[model samples]
Target: MSGSLTAIALDAVLEEHGLTLQQLAALCAVDHDWVSRHIEEGLLTPSQHGGEWRFSSATLLRVRRIANIERQFEALPELAALVADMQEEIDDLRRRLRRAGLE
Candidate 1:
């Protein structure tokens, strides 16, 4: 261990519009089928254009969170999605608090 560990920064391409289903699966370390199942279950949303599903950063982030929740607790995908929803709300509230100079 070191006195202070340096943070390792990762830079992503950050698709402005969105990422392809394959790209999002790679980013979330999940199989494409798993992503499709979640999407079908209404856990993840992807924009449909030209017969392809495109995922935005927000969607990608939620995918990672839901995957983590599912793995950590062996929970169902719907349960994981519920937890992710609460987390997103908390993050939004935190941002609002920061903007109001209360956090």
Candidate 2:
């Protein structure tokens, strides 16, 4: 866990099938209803495999972030999703800059 190789291996494992709804809910400390509502509201989108929804690691992180923002500010789902979108954009931009050796 302290090494880059360990992180890479764990990421590879997670990439195999992504996370189930139950796993994502539990890990994010949110309930199934919360996740379902987000899906209904278009805040989160999960891929389907074998007729079941599967969330990627990125989705898990997004859920956690939105939950945090809602809890901290009592924001509605729409507002929270917007904030999460902005935050994700910032993160993506930072990564791009870093990759380009500009950050």
By lDDT, the best candidate is 2
**Best candidate per TM-score, number?**
2
Candidate 2 Cα misplacement greater than 4 A, ranges: 1-3
Tens digit per residue, CA lDDT, model 1, 4-92: 33211111334445788888999899999999999889898898868999887788889999999999999999999999999999999
**Per-residue lDDT of model 2, residues 11-72, tens digit only:** 67667788999999999999999999999989999999899998887898899999999999
Q: How far off is residue 54 in model 2, in Å?
A: 0.5
Write down the worst ten-residue block by lDDT for model 1: 3-12
| Overall local distance difference test of candidate 2 | 0.91
lDDT of 2 at 6: 90
Misplaced by over 4 Å in model 1 are 1-15
* RMSD, candidate 2, Å: 1.4
- The lDDT values for all models are 0.86, 0.91
> TM-score for all predictions?
0.84, 0.91
